[model samples]
Target chain A: MEFTSETTANGVSELSFTVDDIPGVLWSPADATGNHPLVLLAHGGGQHKRAPGLVARAHRYVTACGFAVAAIDAPGHGDRPRTEQDEQFTAGIRARLSAGEPIGPQVATHNAALAAKAVPEWQATLDALQKAGHAGGPVGFWGLSLGTGIGVPLAAAEPRITAAVLGLAAAETLAEAAARVTVPVEFLLQWDDELVPRDSCLALFDAFASPEKTLHANPGRHLGVPAFELASSERFFTRHLGEGVTQPR
Target chain B: MEFTSETTANGVSELSFTVDDIPGVLWSPADATGNHPLVLLAHGGGQHKRAPGLVARAHRYVTACGFAVAAIDAPGHGDRPRTEQDEQFTAGIRARLSAGEPIGPQVATHNAALAAKAVPEWQATLDALQKAGHAGGPVGFWGLSLGTGIGVPLAAAEPRITAAVLGLAAAETLAEAAARVTVPVEFLLQWDDELVPRDSCLALFDAFASPEKTLHANPGRHLGVPAFELASSERFFTRHLGEGVTQPR
Candidate 1:
């Protein structure tokens, strides 16, 4: 929660900090008259918090929607020391994938564990941000792929999360976590995803316990998710967290 | 759970079956066996129930120690079908490891998920085996490496497990699971393990709630664990579950 750097430009400020190895960043309207609602973001697997996709989404949300944005590198993905298990498992995964074997079980196993650890980390991050007066008001979650697996459970456990943009995830085990998530959710999926089967993705969406949830499935591979989906995701957050204000970008 | 094959040789019968894709095998002594004490075996990471080491240990328990031994493939391994998560995670792991990067985070994520799924699976297997009258009397556990991560929680939750052979596991998260395990344990560790750090391994053993737990640290790398350790593991199980009878092998 220690802010290391702060830079302001065109009414939007970028703040960076080191929260015990969790390299984190915050984006807020620099000239905001008051504290803005925060939207805590999570990056996908093998990607850092500042991945182009996450950064763009954070910027768009803050610039166009008058919301504060925050994100951190998930445990091992960014500027963090890799542990021994990560090494062997990564090697094992590479070896198996090179052999063209189905790696869903491996992926599920990895994601599940990551999700478990991440919930606590996310919770801790929120607490630290709140204590430091960097985060304010209602919080929403946004993560696809690995993000959904972890963020779904995080949002489920944290009552403060009023809405979520979750998708691009599938696993029978994740269904258990999804069942706990009761917030309004905008779920996305790729119909022809080579890694996640259509049935499982659909099954995951169906398993969400949220009373007001929507599905937005596109036809493509895992990486072919349409760009338009992010717009809807932003809108979902805006509807739940905003006073219907769309500030000029 | 449902027996499909039974073979008898030299006062021992090996039973194998498919319990909804969880291939399992049970080794029981054939002669005058009033329901014997059961030793539920869990193999190491990336291994099946019938790995030579596991098979040899199971055989020893049944023949030399007069106990019934049972084991099944963990979710992503052995005779079980690998799912999409497994494939992707495995590939991601391999790619990271081949790049000479530390893969501890990756391995931790995978092992955490495996451990989460394994506990319930092991419980279900025992329940089914007991229902089918293939498992009886006192129950114990034996697992190392990935086995310890999963098996520790299993033994903790199952009050019937009076003793356990757990080791070669280390993670701050797994320590939470270990704190719940109060059974008598014979914990093993290779001082120079390539995967798990020595301090973390010791910390895991220290986290166990068992008052009668013992640590047997050997001088070797993970793969180079001496065969003598297994002998001691067998002895520990025998001391707790053994009824002063060493049946002829």
Candidate 2:
């Protein structure tokens, strides 16, 4: 683990780092000393680790809860180099769009493939972060869309994750993985999502084995989740990961 | 409206009053002076104005947000006398339960009758409260189950209500009324509800005309709403009715 850059603004410290060539950034209170609850944020498809929404959310979590927020680029996203597989997947989506065919199946297939590689990278990063004493407390996962595609499997396989806020992905490829996730979950769904069928999203929510899972569905297209949800998510993390909380529900 | 009793405890003032023959209670900050946003609390079937859940929520709103909360007994509920119609409805429900029959249709029919009488009483109560200067700001409505039955019609007919937290009923009797409601809504659904069919609840949510409606579904039976929802409702009102808020969403 190595930090390549560090800056402070608005009482938040931003540190850019790498773990085995995977580029990522961490945000925390500028004057922080002891370990804080850490949240791993995964970006949507075609978006990088530093996407505007991710940055804004990171800032809110840090300033409001004094928590550490981190994000890393996916296999072919951000400043990372794209392999031939990534190129082929993009072409497939474009071809489906031109033909007016639903692209969900192809997208799910590619996401599953990407998760195979990305999950190990995420695990290595978390191990490195823990070793460096930056993150060792209760952990949380926040991801939607392609992020959910990757997050379902990651949370299922990662025992360190205590809670997750995930959604906007279908159930076809993720239900089995979702069934393995027993931690508390907050699932988001777009009622009129263009890319994913509403039933599929609801089905995925149904598959979660977590007894404390809650589903928040709003009327919008895929990218149009209401703004109030961000505040809701902050409160969720506070409830599960704040001071004196040591058990996973 | 005439005040019949008043008491103060834990920084909250509880005042009992009546509009015509209908009895109700008002809760507000003990030191409250001048107008504040008011939230109308509707009790579920077989419950009263001062039900345990209602009182707890009222105290929280008053102390946490400085908001005034009020609750009124349904026509044949709380301290009010049960008429012949109420007696027959109760008998019918008891019979259905004994025979192992679904009572939703009968319950909806009875609720519709109760709502017809309760709406006018509520309007009169709101008018009297506003005339007395206790409630003159943005108004919010919170109710579920039997409360939702009455609230669907009340919010549709009353123009002062700006936001509502409603659910736990079906679309069989409330779909048309829900379509006329344009205020922001936070709808709750219990996933494993024994009384209300899940599909019916989903359909009722779909009928809301409000552009900013959100559905929060959790795993539970009819009376098993999780504790976290109360805090979430407080935030919903804060967003739509607190401070410098005059317009209904």
Candidate 3:
């Protein structure tokens, strides 16, 4: 594990790092600090670690909650090299979209292949972060769309993750993994999501074995999650992972 | 409206009142002087204006947000006199419960009858409250279970209500009314609700014409809404109704 670059702005310190060739970024409060809760963010399909949404969320957590947030490029995302399989997956999606065909099933298949490689990468990164004292406290996972595709399996296999906010993925490929996840989950869904069927989203939420799971569904297409949910997630993590700085102060 | 009684406790001023013959209670900050956003709470079946849950919610809104809260007893409920029809409704419910039959249909029928009277009574109460300067600002509604039964039509018919938090009733009797409710809404659903089928609740949420409606479903049965939801409602109302005193300060 090594950091390649660092910068500080707006009370947040952004550090770029790599572990076993997987590039990632970590955001934390700029001031010197002790160990605090860590939140791992997974970007959506076709997006990288520094996608605007992921960066905004990382900054929100770091500044508002005093938590460290990290996001790593999936196997073929961000600054990582893409394999032949990644090329084929991209071509398949383009063909389906141009044909005006539903792309959810194709996206799920590609995401499954990506998750197979990405889950172990996240585990290794968590290991490195903990060793460096950046993440030794309770941890949370935030991911949606392709993120949920990867997160369900990762949360199931990684007992280190105590809570998760996941959604926008199908249940057919992830329900079995979801059944194994017992951590409290906050699932998000778009009522009019064009990519995933509403019933499938509801089914995936049902499969989670967690005793405390809540589904927050809003009316809009995928990507139209209302802004207020970000605040809700802050409260959720604060409740489960100890207090962060009080928000809306 | 006539004030029947008044008391102050825990920074909240409780005022008992009657609009015509319908009994009700209103809660406000003890130091409240000016009119503020109002939230009207409709209690569940067999519960009254001062139901423990309603009172707790009223105080939370009053002391936390400086909002005036009101709840009025439905006809034949609370301090109101019961009619022969109310007697039959109670006898029918008792028989069905003992027979292991679902009481939803019976409850819906009775609530539909109650709502017919309750809606008009509510409008009159609002009229009086507004005239007396107790509630002249943007209004909100909070109700669940039988409260939803009454609230759906009331929100549709009452233009004063700009936002609402409602759920726990079936759609068979309320879908049309729900379709007319264009105000923002926060809908709640218990995933394992025994009295209402999960699909029915989803259908009701779907029927809402509000472009900003959100569904919050948790892993529990009726009467088991997690305590965290109260805080969530506080934020929801604060966001739509206007800033409340910052909570968790």
Candidate 4:
């Protein structure tokens, strides 16, 4: 499937890209001009681009901050149609798990393979943006929750990504893809957060090879953070993206 | 329903409280002695006592650390049976939004009403723990993600709760609850966390009226925090529980 862009009356351009060669939407600012910094926003597990609060917020911030943003729904989410092949793959895993068979390693391997296959689709979207005359040098990849699982690997694989932001996520192992991110990386974590263990997050941070990294801790729970901290994110992005804005202390 | 208790081989007793007024599970540890503090663990949205990762970690910590722990699944999550009444309460709001109707105030009012109704169920669990001799006087609450939403309000409503550890949660306005919490409150936040905005968490911390609060920042995302920071939680709980155990820095 080919990618396309449509301009909405609200001055937002909805760019459609392919996932496993299937169509998906990527919302961007239509009014953006010059060599604006680019951001590719990825949603988390069981969520579409619109469902993940961070993706929507990133779109708003990047657009408002004079940068172009492309928010994509992953292969199984949003407008991307699921094929019978995908269903069979998942069903096979479920069947194995239900039969009292140990499927953990198999599932992990399958996910890694799937992630590897999905990289070309992500790179294609970036190439499309470059072809659209919005090539703003290296793009910034922002991943939320499950998106982090995919984004970390993709960013490491694609050196075209200059910087990356990971929210509410941790590298499952210290030796995994997150440690491989050589570009400037920023990690955000919640302290009393029970959803993800804090030890895993700290371990991932300690494992990162990136010299340009910062960790910020604030007070709020999973969904509560973004609903409450738009300004802080705006400031963080501004500083990191070199937009020259700082939030008050 | 009545509450029940059974002693396990590991010298830890499991106390279960059945709520006839609501469908919920109250799991508490019955091993409180010599100033060993109690921890009340609350799970996130659409979750129950046995939710993977977070709940499991809480149980491990409570058992290993010699702290009494009480955990309850909220109204719509876990073993609790969902009712048509509950369905309508949330479905109505979604329907309204889907129909392009403005229902902001109505949703807020409904949430407030539902929270008011739900508070008693949690209070009942607390009362049952006290009655069963599972909880010590200086009880602390640890809420993960959506659990933090419930914990913040519960801590404010119940004066018996001596301390609180809220992970990844914040209200649009933090003053009312922050002012009401008389005990030490710890707010944990993540930087670059796409799950929750960091500013909202900071606002929540700033809103606290009590001076006995600490904020810890770590590297990682929402799920990453809990996955990585179990040790930090133990340290925080121990510091506030004050049972004289030296924590690992």
DockQ for all models, in order? 0.01, 0.90, 0.96, 0.14
Model 3 global lDDT (CA atoms, 0 to 1) = 0.91
Comparing 2 with 3 on TM-score, the higher-scoring candidate is: 3
lDDT of 4 by residue, B1-249 (tens): 465555443445555567655443333344345445778787765567766765566555556566767676677667676778668866886898799875534533444444565667778877776775555557788875566667767888888787887756554634466667767776676644554556666566666655466565545566556333465566567766765212222
- Using DockQ as the yardstick, the better of models 3 and 4 is 3
Return the DockQ of model 1.
Answer: 0.01
Question: Candidate 1 at residue B223, lDDT?
Answer: 74
Q: What is the TM-score of chain A alone in each candidate?
A: 0.94, 0.96, 0.97, 0.75
- Tens-digit per-residue lDDT, A115-157, candidate 2: 8888998999899999988897889999998889989999999
lDDT of 4: 0.61
lDDT of 3 by residue, B92-195 (tens): 89998999999988888889999999999889999999998888677999999888988999999999998999998889999999999999999999999998
Order of models, best lDDT first:
2, 3, 1, 4
For model 2, the stretches where C-alpha displacement exceeds 4 angstroms are A243-249, B244-249
Please provide TM-scores, in order, for all candidate models, with all chains considered together. 0.49, 0.96, 0.98, 0.46
Top-scoring candidate (DockQ): 3
DockQ order, best first, reads 3, 2, 4, 1
Which parts of model 4 are misplaced by more than 4 Å?
Answer: A1-5, A52-55, A81-113, A192-195, A217-224, A244-249, B1-249
Report the lDDT tens digits of candidate 1 across residue range B223-245: 76666556566667777786523
**Which lDDT value does model 3 have at B53?**
86
Give model 1's TM-score versus the native structure. Answer: 0.49
Better of 2 and 3 by DockQ: 3
Model 3 C-alpha lDDT per residue in residues A44-161, reported as the tens digit of each score: 9989999999999999998888889999999889899999999998998899899999999989989999999999999999999999889878999999999999999999999999
